[model samples]
Every structure is written in structure tokens, then in C-alpha cells.
Target: MNSKKVRILVAKPGLDGHDRGARVVARALRDAGFEVIYTGLHQTPEQIAETALQEDVDAVGLSILSGAHMTLVPRVKKLLRDNGMGDVLMVVGGIIPEDDGRELINNGHADQVFTPGEPLDNITDYIGSKIRS
Candidate 1:
């Protein structure tokens, strides 16, 4: 096992029932040697933040495809910060537009945003780089 195992919480937030992408990302992260905890589906920001706190994860990765990224990401970030877990890196992936992605990052909601079809290695490398630093 890798000496530096980054604990990550991969969550599917909102009514987005399409979880194939989220599941694939979780598997890729696991294969990359990070310990991944996946929150099944239909999770709210509160639930995700609470899970991140309880799991002591180094990062929280949310997969949002319902065009609710704007509302959801900031809420998640705020909740985490309020719960004293502000250091936990937050990331979002899925059908997010470039403008919205930038907004989320600028608002300090997410560290990065991965759109659909981005390689798995990209996600793994990003997580590794963030956690290892």
C-alpha cells in the first residue's frame, strides 16, 4: 500500500441519479491508492459536509450533473467551513459549464472542476497533488 493514502469522500449530490461517472471516478481513485468513501446518491450539501467531517477525509469530491452545481458547491463549502473542515479540499465534476466552474473556484467553493470526459488519471493526479502538498 502507498505510505501516503489520501482519504477522500466522493459524493453524488442532489437528484442526479446518473452515477456511472461518479462510480468510475471512485474506482479510479481507489486504484490510484487513495482510500475512497462514496456516498451513494441524492445527497445534500449538509449530508456531504457531515460525511466529510465524520470520515476525516482529506478531500471531498462531488459529482453534480443536474445543473445545480451553482447552488450546491457553495453550500457544501460553507457547511464544511462552518464545521471546522475548511482545510478539506473540495472538487466538482460533471456537466458543468466553464463559466459556472470558474465562478465556483472564484467563490472558494471548489479547488478544481472536471468536466465530462476528462481522464481518470487527471482526477487522480489532481487529488494526489492537492493532498500531498
Candidate 2:
């Protein structure tokens, strides 16, 4: 078995105060053998991108329930790209509408968007596959 472990940063961006889902997912990712970093709450796009760069994380998983994903998600993506961290995998979760999720993917804001109630394993598997590929 490969001994390498993936590092992921799980952050709650914008004014979203509901972090229950983010906390659950972060724990689940850690249990799945990922080195997970949970960035409390109310993080800005620049802060998230900066953390991802500084931590040298393999991926960034954002948990946003504020319905401002349309703005925040893309901004983070842009900042990462601008900071030359464009290679990192970007994934988002929490209370997102299907159309918005599709738009995010189509516009390159995120590689995947997980909705509420999706199995945690699905997220782990997706990140694993994307990183290994």
C-alpha cells in the first residue's frame, strides 16, 4: 500500500456561521486517512488561498452555507490561480443548489461540489482519485 498521505484544507468561508457540516466532513476526511486542516469559520477567499499555499495542501475543500458561493467560490479559485496555486484541487460542499454547483464546475471554480447528505466516503474517494490522477 502507498504510504503517502493526502493533505487537505477544509475551510468555512464568508459569513456562514453554521459550521456543523464542515466540522463533520473535516473529521470524516481525517478518519479516511487524510491530513485535514480545519480553518474555523468566516475565512476570506484570500485567507483560504493563502493557507492552502502556506500549508502546501494537496487540495482545498470549502464548506459554505451562506448562499454566497456564487461569489466566494470563484474568488477563491481566482486567488489560488493568481498566487500560482492553480494546481491544487478545489472542492466545495454544503447547501448548494444544483444549478449553482454546475456553474461552479463549468466555470472552473471547483472540480466537484457535494450537497448536503452525500456520503462522506464519496468526498474522500473523489479527492483521492483527483489527487492520484
Candidate 3:
């Protein structure tokens, strides 16, 4: 039993002001014993990657509802990799179409994309299964 908590940085990038879902998921990850850092709102890709690097997090969870997924997600992913945190698991959630989500995964930008109505437990389980390898 390592006893180390998995550190997760949950960010609401772009001009999206709606963060209720992000907050709920942050709380859920915390409840699941992961250390969660949530950047409030309107964060730039540079800001998100900088925060993740500074926090030394194991993963990053992006909550995007702003219809700017294609533009924002990839930039953030590139910055994360550029900052030498490429191995950090990146997951996205919120109003993204299935095709778009798959494209993000296929393009190697995202590790996972979660949509609305997804069980919170599934997110927790997925991260738990991937973290310590």
C-alpha cells in the first residue's frame, strides 16, 4: 500500500463560466482519495499547463462546455507535452460530440473523453486502474 494520493488537476479552460459539473467531479475525486486541484474558470492553456507542472500532478481533468473543444483541448495537450509532462493522463468531460471525442483520442491528445450522464464512479475507476502502472 503506497499510501500516496493521486494528484489530479481539474481545470475549466476557456471562457466557459459554467463549473457546477467540474466542482461536482472535483469533489467526487477528492472523496475517492485523489488530491484534486481545480483552476476556477477562464483559464488559458498556458495557465493550465503551468499549474499542472507546478502542482506536480499525476493527471489533468479538463471540463469544457464552451464549444471550443477542438481549439482548446489540443493546445492544452501540446503544452502539457511540451512542458515535459507528457505522461500525465489527460481526461476531458462535457458537451463534446462522440466523433470529436474520438478524434481527440485518436489524435493522441486525450486519454479519455467523458460526456454528460456518465457515472462519476467510472471516471474514478478508470483513473485508479491507470495511475500506478
Candidate 4:
């Protein structure tokens, strides 16, 4: 059995100063036995992608509530792909609209779009299933 912990980078991108949810999620993920890197507030997409590469994480969780997901998710996704990290699991959580979430997934911008009220187990279980560590 592989004992390597699933590494995840939790990033807060853009000028959205609200990070309570991101922190909460990060903590829960840590408790769930994943190695999580929390990049504190106000991060650019470039920085996020760079960190993802540097950390060699298995997944990235983008927590955005600034209403800039439409612009940010794509930019980050592009950067990840550009850097040859395209297969890295990409997940976004925030106040995204239902249609927008579907569009993000449909458009291949994100592997999953999670909105408010999703149980922590859902996130943890989904990641555990998708990624074998």
C-alpha cells in the first residue's frame, strides 16, 4: 500500500480578503490526513501555478469568493496547463453560480466546482476517490 499522503494546495486568489471558508476547509483537509499547503490571502494566478509546481501537489483547491472566478479559474488553469501540470486535479469552491459551475466543468476549466454548504466529507471523499496516495 502506498503511504504517501495526498498533497493539496489550497489557494486564495485575487483581492478577495475573505478567507474564513478557505481556512476552515484547509484545516478539515489536514485533519482528513492530506498534506495541505495553505497559501494565505491575495494570491495571483502565476504564484498559484508556481507554487503548485514547486510543491508537486496532487491537487489544487482554489477558494474564491471575490466574484472573479470566471477570470481567475481560467487563468490559473491555463498557467497549470502551460507549465505541464495539466493532469493535476483542479477543484474550485466558492459562491459560484450553478450555471457557471457547470460551465467551468463542461468547459474543462475545472475538474469539480463546489459551492457553499457542501459537506467536508464530500470534498475529502471525492479527493480520496479521485487520487490514490
Q: List the residue pairs that clash in candidate 2.
A: none
Across residues 4-123, which tens digit of lDDT does each residue of candidate 4 receive? Answer: 778999999999988988999999999999999999999999999999999999999999998999999999999999999999999999999999999999999999998999999999
lDDT by residue (1-133, candidate 2, tens digit) is 2566888999999999999999998999899889999989889998999999899889999998889999999999999999898888999998999999999999899999999889989989999888987
What local lDDT does model 2 show for residue 50?
91
Question: Which regions of candidate 2 fall more than 4 Å away from where they truly are?
Answer: 1-4
TM-score, candidate number 1: 0.96
Clashing pairs in 3: none
lDDT of 1 by residue, 4-47 (tens): 66899999988999899999999999999899999999998899
- TM-score each candidate: 0.96, 0.95, 0.97, 0.96
Instruction: Write model 3 residue lDDT over 1-133, tens digit each, in one string.
Output: 2777889999999999989889999999999989999999999999999999999999999999989999999999999999999989999999999999999999999999999999999999998788976
Clash totals for all models, in order? 0, 0, 0, 0
Q: Which stretches of candidate 3 lie over 4 Å from their true place?
A: none
Provide C-alpha RMSD values for all models, in order: 1.7, 1.4, 1.0, 1.2
Candidate lDDT values, in order: 0.92, 0.92, 0.95, 0.94
Q: By lDDT, who's the top model here? A: 3
